[model samples]
Target: MTARALQRMIHVGCRELGLDADTRRDLQLVATGKASMAEMSEAELAKLLEALKARGFKPGFKPGVEPGAKGRRPAAPRPDLRYIHVLWGLLGKAGALKKPGRDGLNAFLRTRFEGKWGSVPIDIDALRDAGQINDVTRALKDMCRRAGVDT
Candidate 1:
């Protein structure tokens, strides 16, 4: 692997393990024969990777996935807002929602998915970053199904 990729793996591993500065420094010295990872040669970078592996560090490890995980990452849960809009329209027509527009949609989501949708703000941009999109979408689908509407 390239030195840059190896460096990134090391940094990620360090952050994951919460390694202290002295431990990082010691790793740097052992890996590169230098005090900095930035200056390490390709061979040294390989050594560093090996050292990290020996310490049980799995490169590219991600939260919620088992170590040595293979295959595709889990798909994000969020659905497009358009799908939400269509589902909301159906709910509104079914007399399930009292408010109109996005405000009404937020109210519906809050009521339907209390804990998951509680933290998501009403604004579109904010909702995009809220990381609760998938839950909201699932709730919307459930609402649609309950109202006898196909999503």
Candidate 2:
């Protein structure tokens, strides 16, 4: 697969639709045929995301067993626990977020991130990964709720 294609899709489309990891993985499995795509109904697929989003997740297609998910790739270390704390730091300070315009989130990222995260997708994914910071979805949602940010 092309990184250009992936990057373009991530920025131009996937980000806007908000597909979440499992949903993205399911779709990719269907696209790549690793998993049977026939059995699941649209409702079933949407439920996985809907359930999470209902609890405040900023759902998006994650496309594979993410850093945190069932049936994940082995020995990925389950991501960093403190990353959640960093996100909580951002959300805790969300009230102090700059202007609520088109770039509000981007501005937040600029102020919050440094070095490598000064780029797109990198910073965006860091924020997105916050939803999956905890092993359990409820924990993720609780974090989102704490910052008044939709998970």
lDDT winner: 1
Residues 29-146, candidate 2: write the lDDT tens digits: 6444434324444444444334444544443435454645666323323345344444444555666334542245345445544443444433333444553333324443464676
1-28 in candidate 1: lDDT tens per residue? Answer: 7888878888887777778778987987
Off by over 4 Å in 2: 1-96, 116-118, 121-143, 148-151
Off by over 4 Å in 1: 67-151
Whole-model lDDT, candidate 1? 0.71
Best by TM-score: 1
Q: What TM-score do all the candidates reach, one by one?
A: 0.46, 0.20
Error of 1 at 116 (Å): 28
Would you list the clashing residue pairs of candidate 1? 77-134
Clashes of each: 1, 10
